[model samples]
Every structure is written in structure tokens, then in C-alpha cells.
Target chain A: MREITYREALREALFEEMRRDDRVFLMGEEVGHYDGAYKVSQGLLAEFGERRVIDTPIAEAGFAGIGIGAAMTGLRPIVEFMSWNFSFVAFDQIISNASKTYSMSGGKIKVPIVFRGPNGAAAQVAAQHSHTVEAFYAHIPGLWVANPSTPRDAKGLLKAAIRMDDPVVFLEGETLYNLKGEVPDASEDEIIPFGKARIAREGKDCTLIAWGAPFHTALAVADRLAKEAGIECDVIDPRTLRPIDETAILESVAKTNRCVIVHETWPYGGPGAEMVDLIQREAFDYLDAPVLRVGSLDVPMPYAKNLESLVLPTPERIETAIRRVTYREER
Target chain B: MSEVKVERWLDDYREMLLIRRFEEESARAYAQGKIGGFLHLYIGQESIAVAAATTIEKGDLVFQTYRDHGTALALGMTPEAAMAELFGKDTGCSRGLGGSMHYFDVENGFYGGWGIVGGHLALAAGAAFRSKYLGEDQVTLCFFGEGATNIGGFHEAMSLAGLWKLPAVFICENNQYAMGTPLSRTSPLSDLSVKAAGYGMVGDRFEGYDVDVVREHLKKAIDRARSGEGPSFLEIETYRFRGHSMSDPGKYRTAEELEERKKKDPILLILGKLRDAGVDEAKIEAIEDEVEERIEAALKHADEAPFPEESLLYETVTVEKF
Candidate 1:
């Protein structure tokens, strides 16, 4: 195993997949020459050449639709949005064209494309540039939404997203691009399957669920709770939100007898709300407390540093929810 | 007349007549409540799609807007499949999932019957991108109404097609209106093809009433695309004899205006051309009779076809759902 940055992991996945299949090409605003806005596609233009590494003008809807169209005709395109915030302009292409084309054409058309980029808040980027779009995309039936929390998962999940015969929305963590984690060597070819949850930290006291940037927060909070309050939490990260690993969450909840979902998305009708409903409905009788959720405040992300920090689900809020669910008192 | 000219005229006339009669029966089916949802017929604009079909090769792809029955029929979709799709039967081209507005037959190089006005143009550019990337000579034909030309997707698609030098021919079938809004009210310029200059693409505009003229113009564009000369914008001036959809009464235009446009009907124009080429009266009448019989058979097949099974509802959402 070798430690690599999440950004490096993603680039490796793209490089490997494009090499494996000639049909695979990367197209986006700054993917080529610019080496991607986040530099995730650095050196891709030189390695894959201009034909495979395509650069387009600042037109999200156009390129997104083009990716869907290319997928329909037998090309596997990895269309990158500068950020998930920009995907709204291309929402129709992703929702209407990519998602529905497969079923609309009665399986005659297969949109084997991946729309990937950083999602959720990154520092003080404000409301428009910082959007956690997993809920909106996951709500669509024909789409797969994968939120990778680590460098290893980023590489494995991205590879799987590209190879799968369906449309995938790969939500990367803007803040986690440089996060270092262990990834298998190139010859290993590790690919993670969807609909599976990774128990980041195992415990029996309470089930603490989160994903993306929030997953790292949950892990840190779980470690702190065990040391300071003796509240050992079963920290879980269900990477893919759409075909969620219900069995893992319910199984952990059935043992722990309580749960608290933490996420960077808004509280109102978000993935956290869906998780709460699922946990309460499936594991209701086993619960000692109501399944609670700690999510971003139900308001537009603020521009000020202090207000922006408060709007997102901070470690303090997640710790409070864990204590409440576990019935542990403050120190 | 030369035997080759007569044969070409007869073939073109039969294809145009088939589309006209198919659309006419679709209107009847809509009125009878057999076909639910919006039915946008291509009654007077048959020559554009038929001519396009004649101009492209087997590997060339075609994309069209919601008013796509004509394109589907012209691209060799069986009458039964198109009619059954409108009727919402399991035997339909899209297997009852896609109604009239989403007819698809990929095997025949017809990608789809996209409902969104200009949303599909970018997809067409993408298809052309794939061809260019693979070094294939396949040309992509994207058809849309003049209404679609005003949308953002239209500009974005055109800009990309032009910038990338994609093998795409953007055919704007300016049938005078975007739904009920006339071109005079919607667009500033009467010649929509002039918009191509902004994207650095060549432009052409011609009457769509004559099948031969439509074919020749489309062939020129298609040939340029095949030769890697980049995309072209083609404004095929035509008129829809029917309203925008079945629900439209078309009171926006006067009865006299409608009659005046009908005088240049594409089907009639092709029929007259066939007669002038010395095609026998018996041959023309037999073609008309055959088209009539085909429509009747399609209607019967659609009427008898079964609705999709309930299990099919859960299928095709993804290739393999987790």
C-alpha cells in the first residue's frame, strides 16, 4: 500500500480507466491545458493527448448534454463540472437526458457516463459556489450518487463509476482533495462495489453515520467521545447515498440501540432526513432513543467566516447529537 | 423522362406520402383518445425528413424534437412500431416507456425523439464529437423547430459544434412558429441560418416544399460534415399544416393563411414532381393506395397491442440496480 492524495487517486483512476478503454475520454471546462480547475486533471492532456482529454468553453449544459449524447452512441465520457454548484445549469441534461435516456429508450440507450467534481462547502465560498447536490441527484432513480470520503475510496469508487453501465454523479469533497490516505498499488486494481457501508470505527455504544467531509468529522468526534466521555460510537460511512447500505446502518443501530446522522447538506428534506426515516422505520423497535440528525442549518450558506462555520454541521454539533442519542451527559 | 429520374421521383413520392398519411392517422388516434399526451404532427413538412433520410448513409445518426413521427418513419422505423408507440403499447419502439414525443430506433441510426426543444442539440454535438474522436466519418443530423433556436441549449450546442469542428448538421426546420408564436414575433432575423456566422459555421436556407431540393441541400451539408469540414446550420423553410399540437385550434393564423400555405404542401409538391417525370397515373395511384393500406394496418396493430406488464415498470431504470 502507498499513501497518496485524494486528487492523485482520482487522476490515477481516470488515467487507468482511459487506458483500459479507448472510448473513455475526459471533457470539461478546464480539464485540458488548464489541467482542471482543481488540478485533478493535471498532466492528463499531455498523457492522453488532446483527442481524449477535451477542453470546452464555459458551457455546463452543453457539455453535459454532449456527454450524455456521446454515451448514447457508445463513448464512455467522464464529464467534469468545475464544481457541483455549476451542475444546476446543466441539471436538465443530467436529469432529463442522462438519467432518463436509458429507461426512455427501453434499454436501447446506455448512458455510461460519469459527472464528477467537488461538492459541498469549501471554506467561505458562499451559497452559490457551495452546494451539496447529493440529495437532488440521489432522488433520481436512474442515477448513482457516490460520495467518497477518503483517497482509497475516491480511487476505487471512481473506477467503478466509470466502468458501470449507468450514469453516476461522483461527488468529491472540495476540502479533502489533498487529504492523504493509503491506496493499493497500480497492479492491484482495487474497485469498490456500490451499496456497501464502511464501518470507519467499530463500537457498541451508538451508531454515528456520515459521509464525505462529514465522515472525517464523525471519526474524530467518535475518538474524542470514547476518550473524554467513554461513549464508544460505531462510526459508519455509507459512501454511495442512492443505493444506500441499509443493512449496515440497521444492523449497527440494532446493536447500538441508537443513531445520529451527520451530513454537510441542509437539514430540510436532505439525505439526513432520508436516513432518519429509514432508521426509524426499519429499526424502530430496537431503538432506545429517536434517531436524530446533525446537518447544515436550513439556510443559504453565509459569506462571513464565523457565520459560514456555524451554518455547516461542526464537530461540536455532531458531538452534541451523539451524546443525546447515547444518553451521555456533558463533561 | 429518363428511367432513373422516374424511379427516383416514385421512391421520393412514396416516402413523403407515407409520412403524411401516418401523421394524419396519428391525429385521428389522438382524437379517439387512443394516443394520450401531446401529439405534434408533421403534416406539411414531410419532405424535410424524407429528404434527410435519403441524403444520409446507414451509420449517420439523426436527432429530432418532439414533432418526430416524420423523422422516425423516414429513418425506416416500421409503421407498426411508430403507431404502437403513439398508442402506448409494449410493442412500441421505446417499448411503451417513451410515448409519441420520445420515439427511438437506434438500429436505424435514429437516436431519439427528444421532447425538449433545444436540449437535444448538445447531445447531437456529443454524438458528432464521438465520431471525430474515433476518426469515424459518421455525420450527425440534428433537427429542431425554429422555437428551439432561441433557447440557450441551441447557442451552447452550436458554439461547441463550431469550435470542435464536429461532424454535425444542425437542421432548423423553421416551420414558421415555436408552438403558436410566429417567427416574426420570436426571432429578429427572418433568415435563422445567419445565426451560424456567429459560431463560425457555414449557413444555408432553402424551401422545404420540394423533396429534390431539400435532398440536394442536405446532401451538401452532410458531405461537408463527413469530410471533417465542421458543422453547418441549415434553415429549411417549411410549414406545418396541423396546429403545433392536437390541442391547438390554430386561431393565431387566419383560415386564408392556412389554405395559402397548404397550396405548397410538401406531399403534393413531390406528387406533382412524380407526374412531371412521366410516372404513370396507375403507378402514382397504386403508391397512394399502398400508403393508405399501410396506415390502416398500423392502426389495427396498435389497437390490438397490449399495454406493458406491471413488472416492466421496475425494469430498465438501470442496467443492474444495486
Candidate 2:
């Protein structure tokens, strides 16, 4: 095992997958020559050359649809959106063309493409640049939505997303790129399967479920609750949102008898709402308290530093939900 | 007349007539409540599809808009499969999932029956990108209506196709109206091919009334693409005799205008050419009789075909369910 940055881990996945399969190519703005907006595609252009590591104009819809078309004809394209916020421009292509092509063509078309980029708020990028698009993409049927929270998950899940014979929306945390964590050696080739939740920290008193940037916050809050109030929490990170590890969440809720979901997406009609519904419906009898959720405020992300910080789910906000679900008094 | 000329003329005539008969039967099926959803007929514009079929090779790919039955048939999709798809049956090209707007037959290199006007253009470019990337000599033919030329997807796809030098031929079948909005009202220029200059691509415009003329133009574009000369924008001027869909009465145009346009019907134009080529009257009648029988068989097959099993509903959503 080697400690590596999440960005490095993702790059390794691309490098490995591209080497393994010639059909796999990386195409996006600044991916080549500029080495990617976030540098996740650094060194790829030099190693893979211009043909494999392509750079395109700032046309998301064009490249996205092109990626879908390429996938349909037998090339695995990794289309990078500089940020998930920009995917809206290509929403019709991703939703209508990529997602439905398989079923619409009666399984004759397979869009083995990966649309990946930094997702959710990064610094004070504000409304237009900051969008947590997992809920919107996950709601679609023919897509696999993977939001990896750790370096290991980043490398493994990305490898799996690239290899899968379906369209995948790979959401990387904007702030988590530089976060260091242990990743399996290259020879090991660890590929994490989707629809499996990782129990970051296990306990029985309460369950705190989160993903992406919010997963790190949940871990910190869980540590704090255990140290200060002895309120042990089972921290769970659902890396994939679409096929979602319902069993893991239900079993954790059944054991803990309480649940609290935290995420950077908006509260209204978010993946958190879906999780709440799933928990209440499947593990209703086991619950000692109603499953609560701590999500970003339902308003558009604000530009001001203070308001922006308050808009996203913070550690304090997550802890409050945890305490409420476990019936612990706020400190 | 040379045998080759007669053979090509006869093949073109039969193909166009087959499409016409298929579309007419589809309209009847829709009226009888056998085919649900929208049914877009390719009546007056058979020359473009027939020309496309004549130009491309086996590996060449064809993409089309919602009004795709003609292109599907021209690309070798059996009438039974196309009719069954419209009828929403298991025997359909897309196994009853795609319906009228999504008749897909990948085996024939017919990529789709895309419903979105301009959305499939990018995908078409992408397919061409794959060909160029792999050094494969396959050309991609993207057929879209004039309405699609105005959308963001159209510009984006065109820009990429030009920038990448992809082997794609963007065929804009400007059949006057985009679902009843005439090109005069929608497009800034009457010659939609002029849009290609903005993207640094070559432009060609021609009347789509004669299959031979349309095929010759299409062949030049497809040959250029195959030779790695990049994409070309072809604005094929044509007309749709039927409404945009089954629901449209085409009340926007006057009876006189419709009648005037009908006089230049592609089928009639080709029929006249066939007669001038000394093709026998009995031979033409036999082809018509054969097309009628095929259309009748397609209708009967579609009528008897079963709806898809409920389990198929969950199957095709994703290739491998997780």
C-alpha cells in the first residue's frame, strides 16, 4: 500500500485503463497540453500521445454527444467536464442520448463512456460553477453515478466505471483531490464494485450516512460525538448513488435503530430525500427515531464566503442531525 | 439503354416506392390505433434516403432524425421490422422499445431513429471520430431536418466535426418545413449549407427530387469524408407531401402550394426517368405489385406480432444490471 493523493489515484486509473484498452481515450477541455483543469489528467497526454489524450474546445454538449456516439460505435471515451456544473449544457445529450440509447436501440447500442469531473462546491465558486449533480444524474435509469470519497475509492471506483458496459457519471470531490489516502499498489489492480457502501466507522448507537465531501465531515463529526458524548455512530459512505447499497444502509439502520444522512446537495428532492424514504420504508420498525437528513440549504449556492459556508452541510450541522437521530442533547 | 442504367433505375424506383408504401401503411395503422405515438412519414423526400443508400458502403454508418422510416428501409432494415417497431411489437427492430421515433438496426450500420432534432449530430460526429481514431475507412452520414440546424447541438457538433476533421457528412434534409415551421421563418439563410462556412467546412446544396443527382452529390461528400478530407454540409432541398406527423393537417400551406409542390414529386420524377430509359410499362407495374405485396406482408406480420414480454421492460435499461 502507498499513500497517494486522490488526484494521483484517479490519474493512475486513467493511465492503467487506457493502457489496458486502446479503445479508451480521454477527451475534454484542458485534458491534454494543459494537463486537465484539476491536473487529474497530468502526464496522460505525454504518455498516451495526442490521439488517446485529446483536448477539445470548451464545448461540453458537442464533446459529450460525441463521446456518446463514439461509445455507441465501439470506442470507450472518457469525457471530462471541467466541472459538473458545466454538464447542464450537455444535459440533453447525457440524459436523452447516452442514457436512453441502450434501451432505445433494444440493447444494440452500448455507451461504455465515463463523464467525470470535480463535482459540488469548491472554495467560493458560487452558483454557476458549483453544482452537486449526483441527484439529477442518479435519477436517470441507464446511468451509473459514482461519487468516490477517498483515494482508494477514487482509483477503484473510477477503474470500475471505465470498465463497466454502461454510461457512468463519475463525480470527484473538488476539495478531496489533494487529500492523501492509502491506495493499493498498481500490481494489485483493486477495482471497487458499485452498489456497495463502505462503513467508514462502525458503531451501533446511530448511523451517519454521507458521500463525497460530506463523507469526510461525517467522519470528523462521528469522532467528535464519540469523544465528547460517547454517542458512537456508524459512519457510512455510499460511493455509488444510482444502484445505491440499500442493503448496507438498511442493515446499518436496523442495527443502529436511527439514521441521519448528510450531503452537499440541496435538501429538496436530493439523493438524501431518497435515502430517507428508503430507510423509513425498509427499516421503519427498527427505528427508534425518524431518519433525519443534513443537506445543503435548498437555495442556490451563495457567493459570499460566510453565506457559502453556511449553505453547505458543515460538521456541526451533521453532528446536530446525528444527535437528534440518537436522542442526544446538543452540547 | 445499358443494362447497368436500367438496373440502377429499377433498384432506385423499387426502393423509393417501398418507402412510400411503408409510410402510407404506417399512416393507416396509426389511424386504426394499431401504432401509438407520433408517425413521421417520408413521402416527398424519398430521394435523399435512396441516394444515401446508394452512396455508402457496408461499414458506413447512417444517423437520422425522428422521420426515419425511409432511411431505415433504404439502409436495408426489413419492412417487417420497421412496421413491427411502429406497431410496438417484439419483432420490431428495437424489440418494441424504441417505437416510431427510434427504429435502430445496428447490423445494417443504421445507428438510430433519434427523436431529438439535432441531438444525434454529435453522436454521428463521435462515430466518425472513432473511425478516424482507429484509422478505419468508414464514413458517417448524419441526416437531420432543417430545424436541427438552428439548435445548439447542431452548431456544437458541426464545430467539432470541422475542428476534428472527422469523416462525417452532415446531410440537412431541408424539406421546407420543420414540423410546420417553414425554413423561411426558421433559418436566416435559404441555403442552409452556408452554415458550413462558419465551421470551416465545405458546403453543397442541391435539389433532392432526382435520385441520380442526389446520389452523385452524396457520393462526392462521402468520398471526401472517406479520403480524410473532413466533414461536409449538404443541404438537400426537398418537400414532405404529408404533414410533419400523423397529427398535422398541414393547414399552414394553401392547397395550391401543396398541389404545386406535388407536381415535382420524387417518385413521379423517377417514374418519368424510368419510362424514358425504355423500362417496360409491365416491368414497372410488376415492381409496384411486388412492393404492394411486401407492404401487405409487413402489415400482417406487424398485426400478428406480440407485444414484448414484461420482463424485457427491465432487461434493456442497462447492458449489465448491477
TM-score of B-chain for each predicted structure, in order: 0.98, 0.99
Per-residue alpha-carbon lDDT of candidate 1 for residues B1-322, written as tens digits (9 for 90 to 100): 7788778778888888899889888898898899999999999999899899988999999999989999999999999999999999999999999999998999999999998879999999999999998899999999999999889999999999999999999999989978889999998898898999999999999999988899999999999999989999999999998899999999899999999999998877777877776677999999889999999999999999999888887788998677
Q: Write one digit per residue (lDDT tens) for candidate 2, span A206-266.
A: 9889999989988998998899999999989999999899999999888999988899898
Compared with the true structure, what per-residue lDDT tens digits does model 2 show for residues B1-322?
7899888989999999999999998898899999899889999999889989988999999999999999999999999999999999999999999999998998898998999878999999999999999999999999999899899999999999999999999999988888888888997798888899999899999999999899899999999999989999999989999999999999998999989999989999989998998888999999999999999999999999999999987899998787
* Residue B140 lDDT (model 2): 98
Candidate that would win on DockQ: 2
Give the local distance difference test score of model 1: 0.92
Interface RMSD of the candidates, in order:
0.7, 0.6
**What are the lDDT scores of the predictions, listed in order?**
0.92, 0.93
lDDT of 1 by residue, A1-331 (tens): 7899999999999999988999999999889998999999999999899999999899999999999999999999999999999999999999989999988887789999999999989989888988898989989999999999999999999999999999999999999999999999989999999999999999999999999998898899999989988899999999899899999999999999989999998878888888888988998899999888898898998999999999888999999988887878577
Clashing residue pairs in all predictions, respectively, total 0, 0
Please identify model 1 stretches exceeding 4 Å from their true place: none
* Predictions' DockQ, in order: 0.85, 0.92
Candidate 2: residue B132 Cα off by (Å): 0.3
